[model samples]
Target: MRTPAAALTGVVALAFADASIVALALPAIYGRFDTTIVGVSWVLTGYAVAVAVAAVTLIAVRRWLPTGPLTMGGLALFAAGSTWCGVAGSLGGLLAGRVVQGIGAAALLSGALELLSAHVGRERGRRLWSGAATAGLAVGPALGGALTEAFDWRVIFIAQVPVALLALVVLALSRAPALEPESGEPTTNPLWATAGYVSLFAGLVGALFLGVLLLVEIWRFSPLAAACVMMALPAGTIAAGRLTATAAPAVRVVGGTLALCAGLVGLALLPSASLAWAAAALFLCGAGSGVVARVLSPAAVPTSAPLVRSGGAVVAAKHAGLVLGLVVIAPLLAGSLTSGAEQAVVTGTGVLLDARMPVQEKLSLALSVRDTFAEAPRGAVPDLAAAVDTTNRSEATTAVVKEVDHRLSAVLTRAFRPAFLAAAALALLTVLAAFAVRKTPIGYPRWRAAPTAILAVLVLAGPALVAAEVAGGALDHGRYQETDPCAAPADPYPGDGVDALVQRVAYGALHGAACELGLSRERFLLALAGQPGFAGVEWDPSTVERTVRAAADRALDDVQQRGDLPGWTITLVRAAVRSMPLEELLRVVGLR
Candidate 1:
């Protein structure tokens, strides 16, 4: 009995570990596949969705499948899926492999629990299962990080193959009993259990998903460093386990939910990318999750039902929550990040245009800075200093650029706060759901009344906190106003020809228009270079600047000759010079 229990525990640990082991590796996967965050999120989502679907199906047919064969078959499938994931060449292929892994994981989870219940009774089995899963959750991120850093993300999955095989061997040698259905009415309510499970996982999405992204993408930590930081979550869980072991289910649920909510709120209010702040938040999350699991697991699936069915239901609910959380949060996060980047570019460009420098030098500096911003990887904060040409720039100019860099970094950091707030909102919902868990019969009404009042306070307090922060200007939503560079006093030029006028306007208007359009100068130029009649045009800095000046010259010449050109003619010319290549502008003016 002991040997079989130990073996099954190992299998359970692996299955749970796989759920989050890949989180720290997500950025690496995104880079490797050249995929969007939403696309890359499908890696985690696909696995979770597969697990939920398969677990449900397995539960429906629990009475027909024998525990021994089910466990062995799951191990085989898990091994195969791991192999496929390790060798997958594309995002689509990797997603397919993850689904296979999810299916196998569901089977193993349900079957192992069923076998344990048959061998040692439901009470002992639940304790062992929870402990094993907690152990896996604790180690997954760190192990995944070490493997991803030392080798590659693929190794994380590949390493799972041997562990699955060993579990299979152990199961075979133990001769575990077949699953059997229970006869009595279930003590726990399935609806309450499902709700609790879903809310628990949904709240965790912020810590596991957004936290990892912030560490790896925005903060620019190596995968190993991110993993090391994430270890706080599991460590908290382990510490809370002993403390919550004898607590009433209701007390544990509420306490855990409160801790998780506090953690998420802390993340939302993060002043900077300080590891100390993140660690404190993650510890709360981990500890809360541990307590929730300890109190909620047995209740999640009624002991009156077949052990396999009950276990399947619980697993399905939890993974489904993960899928749901990602689906909702990923889009919000992506949109916030896009808006933040645009804001940064606009703000940074304004700083450059207003800087005290020679016009020609400013133009050169702007081009260099734009190029630097363009070179930064997606979802990463641009390094402003790296974008400047220090060799030719004055100390004053460099100092200005450094200030712009600081502002850009601040904007980027502020962007992710909304996502964290959204996560905190989700955690608050978990707290509400946890209040629905059945209380002990001894003080049922009195216990329920106090928590009900507390739940209301939490519900109101969460949004209030978010609102206060936003109202305090933690999230800036100001729009960029396009400046009219051609307005008012005209600059005195040595030459009165069309070329000189065009040069003045082009230099004056380009930065303002680009800011209005939320584009870096480099991006705006490259876009123009790609327009009609500009095919095969060289995009070197000098070439792009010359082309813009020439295009402005042609547009001005055309409007002047027409004499009756509308008041908006100059506006059209400016737009053309900003968007169209010089050749395209000449063709539009009938001068090609």
Candidate 2:
């Protein structure tokens, strides 16, 4: 790479990084700007929307302008936008800055390509730009998280000012490169390639956007800690570059899509609030997305079409998908999480009431939790230091507090399940598009559509299974309104005896099941215990059928009511619940 191309590459990385760099900083901005997740999201989408519109619309504009002048001007405007964002007093003002930066970024991206092509070969220039952009997307959030932790979120924009200026300085000092004339009538876009970009970026929302929020808001990790965990993304992305180099295009797309889907599924079903689990899942996402981006991006740009117009298609498709993901997924995520948060607190109330603590301590602790939640920012799990604050520390009180917080985190993690799965499904669409550009595995040239059909089903199955469990969106405002026993218990008790813990979980599950059934816990337990073969050595399917219906009817009812679906629509639900190996579960619930 020549000095000018290298300089432009640096800025291209920064500009694309600018797209997602604000992601980790959003939680801080959330409270600071008094915005919800939906509102704060415009900070991200605004830039992307601007970039998408400008990247395409400016194609005609770029045709007339000299690359040298255009790129220098773009660097200056980018600096101006950064300074504006740094100093903005309101979210609206900051958004305006984002728009400015986005337009400038479009110019930068366009001009960078021209300069690179002039200095390096056309093919090499496109490769460098694509790699830098992909790397930028992967690196942005982690770097933003680090910056936000070290200083204020506003400092992030201030920090970019120097980078853009340094790039401008390099370009100024280097030799001016000549712009290449548009050689082909690149009138039309590659449909499959564009679709691939759309699906790929839309799915990435699960990994980059929601993943960071889970770490900072729900897990109560600091921005720096979240950044450290997110480092797995870039590591895996870089690693996948090497791993997929020899793989065929179709294999890269299908395999990458599968990996991406699996990672998201892993996220949806995360076992605990362990950073290791998150990092592992994100690694899969990173590698998968990296493979997809590298293969699909060049495929979108046709060999015959003008590189600028085709580049515009790729840019427009990607950022538009981001905008699309934010528009669709953000609302879904916000709605589900809001109600889920309230439900979590209501569910935790059961643990509080069930603990062996005295009434006075329970009341005191309840009040403290209520106050903390009432004061917490939207979409954030409150720090509950004072939740167990008392003149004297009682073991039962302390235990209950720990369990409730644990439950909150667990439920919050579950709240994101739908969004993650949605993202995975969206990414899966790219595999269908990838088939349009499929090159068989190196040694498997005769592989036909049968394998493609099977791959499609395999890719589609996971999200379909998870989506079957979809209930309605969460309650309004996610506020902990009152005592409710509806959440399912899944976490192991920390430092708890197995027998004692199992007994507690059994009762908790029974209690929640009974609440759904509109029966008292005692009543539900007695009903199961009275059934024939209750606690029997022989598992009786006949009596089990009776017992299963007794317990499952209420659950199916709730599912129907919540989803506004009719009884017959849930035949699968009936089959699944009817087939559950609930003998053990019922026995545990039946324990005295």
Decoy 2 TM-score against native:
0.75
TM-score of each: 0.75, 0.75
User: For candidate 1, lDDT tens digit of each residue in 228-326?
Assistant: 899998888887755555555676677778777877776666555578767767887887788777767666655676677778888888888788788
* Candidate 1 lDDT score relative to the true structure: 0.72
Query: What's the lDDT for all of these models?
Result: 0.72, 0.72
Query: Which pairs of residues collide in model 2?
Result: 338-478, 339-475
For model 2, residues 1-592, the per-residue Cα lDDT tens digits are 5667778888889988887899899999888886888999999999999989998887777678777778888889999999999999999999999999988888788777767777786667777888888899889999999999999899999998998898888888887555455454322236786788888888886688889898999898999999998888878777775555555667668877887887777677676777987887788788778877767765676445566667777777888888877887788889888767655755566566566654456667877877777777655687665444744867767777777887788778778888888888888887876665575322223444554444354345445433432322222212233333454432312224444444444444454555655544433443443522122223266654454455455445544544434677767766765676666545634532
Candidate 2 residue 330 Cα shift, in angstroms, is 0.6
